[model samples]
Target: MTETAATNEQISATLVLPYLNHAVRMYEQKYASRADIDAAMRFGCGYPKGPLTVLDELGLDTVHDQLAARYAETGDNLHKPADLLTALVGEGRTGKSDGRGFYTYANGEVIADDETPSADDQPQLRHDIKKVGVVGTGTMASGIVQVFAQAGYDVVFVGRGEDKIAGVIGGITKGLDKLIEKGRSDEATKEAVLGRLTGATTREALADVDIVVEAIAEDLDLKLELFRDFDRIIKQGAILATTTSSLPITQLADATSRPESVIGMHFFNPATVMKLVEVVTAPATGADVNETTLALCAKVGKVAVSCADRSGFIVNALLFPYLNDACLLAESGVELSVIDDAIKAEAGFPMGPFQLLDVVGNDVSLAIQKELFAEFKEPGFAPAASLEKVVADGHLGRKTKKGFHDYS
Candidate 1:
């Protein structure tokens, strides 16, 4: 290595010590699980791994020197290494070379033998998909249409009425225009995307499509009814998917005669922007169907995680509970601003809970809470009375101009 490059590496190694020491101390205190700590570092701080994992990777001696220097400078408990870390460093059982430390690395890379295998290992999907059908014309539906069309797939956007279909096209155009104004897309790309998008006021438009994504309202009966109608028209072997966040995939599958072809392709809000897609499989769903859906998500530049048909799946299952807790905190007489500030300052959340609630819309929160509480009946899942009152008052959120805090 050049002298300057080697010197920079040395400097980085020295600087990492205090951070590693703090991580080790936090781990010893049992403040959070190793996996969670690692996730926080990766998500919150944009680090490759948690502090302990990095120390293990960089060598304990290197981390120790940095921590010792930090301790000399600050004399704080945070700079002190945990007993477990100290003992490991003392014995020189440093990372990859020793086949030990926080994780076992084979050939200097962490092995995934014990880690959960991803769904991507099965097979690459055949992207012979020339056409796709997206039902519903809401914000999410428009976003999905934009995503598919932008990827060069002929997309049919279906809604109940001609006016609604036109509105969806307008929404897509507005979104694309915003992208152009921001210099994210060229005029040709925008025209190409719009060219691939077609709006229809009937399910008949989906007849020639290879994949059908239902982005209808989050009503199980309405979705099941649509699936029943769709099954009668859609071509055989076509993959049936839903964007439902809370409904059971099995219930939607039961609406169709070919349950084996049905699956859940849940996308987050502003579908065009989010990277994660939950590819849910019902009990009767065929392996090929799941494989194809996952492949489609990847083709559209999304990360897919396959999961069993369950309420909330992965992200929502863990996230909503935390949000529910925040609601309860606000309902317990804490000032909305104070509750938000406390969580943001103490927990490092990007937005305070109340602000997030306002942004997500109280009506959406109430609906999700009702579904969760009905299924699990956990006391923690209980909906906040304040939230109920806000929705009842029609102060939904930004769309309604008022919620926990008034926009006017």
Candidate 2:
């Protein structure tokens, strides 16, 4: 291979190897199924291939060696090769090349033999959730409102002001109109969806709502405050869910009288478009509440993956660390553009880490990293200093037109 190709491979390994390793560990722990784990990254994060599949393609032996080398170099436990990977290698089931690894293969293609439970086999949904309340009028909130309204639920959204409420409604209308122009929807459908939506400026409007989804800012104080209010104002046995990506769901639940009803319904941005909803369950989350949330996600045509209420949950837990490792690689003298190109070309990721960081915002990335570091207390999980410097300098990302790379 050429010099450039070698660097590309090195950078790609530096970033993705740990994630692939963690995916193996996650599978071993039974946090999620092989299928759900793969789907979470594929559909949820838009990864070209899930970590296990990537491990298969990269060859278990190859990954093991790379991870072992990385572990020796960094002395990071996360870099240590997963026991499952080592076992597979020892058994001589390297990867697709040898027709085995994390999955069975035929003719260099993965065969379908998933033994995991199907998404179709879900518990009965709660019958009381005819009316849904969504708090916040930002992009995520508006998309969620449209999702519930379109799904034939009576959606009541709360905003701080009439202008924000109207703005969310207008945005949803414009989106529906765009769909009409694309011939994917009709006037009647648009009107019916819009007719199902109601907006209010007070928390009192949500008192009668069967389920309230909080999509406000990602501040713990704000979410705890909202949860307290939700506990007081919402009816008995109603679900109080937050869309927080980084905060501890258990703490959020502790703030509410009905901890069993408090759960994390973490929807991806552009809720109408993303197919994944992580139905995170706190220790106090009721089994029925978990079932209801899963059933509701299926109702809205999303693939819901259930996980324990941990800091980053699934996607962010695995993703930001890789991105942070990429930052470290850049700080060690690799050109940002070169690292980006190598990742795209070698790993077939949707975008390079830098590109994704810019779109996601470096400040947000740093915040999530901090949360992860705080939760796991892993030295390797610490936020990259380079990432912190960029955020501190106010080069947030696309929002600020500057980050690892300049948008301007």
**TM-score per model over all chains:** 0.73, 0.94
What would the per-residue lDDT of candidate 2 be over residues 1-408, giving only the tens digit for each residue? 234444776777778899899889888877777777888899888888888888888889988998999899889998999898898899999999999887889998777666645557665696468999999999999999999999999999999999999999899999999999999999999999999999999999999998999999988899999999998899988899999888889999999888999989999988999999999999999999999998899998999988998878889988999899888888777788888899999888889999999999999999999988998898888888999999999999999999989989
TM-score quality measure for candidate 2? 0.94
- Cα deviation of 324 in candidate 2 (Å)? 0.4
| lDDT score for residue 385 of model 1 | 82
Count the clashes in each prediction: 0, 0
Runs in model 1 deviating more than 4 A are 1-113, 116-123
Supply the global lDDT for candidate 2: 0.89
lDDT of 1 at 350: 68
Quote model 1's TM-score.
0.73
Misplaced by over 4 Å in model 2 are: 1-6, 91-93, 96-100, 104-114, 118-120
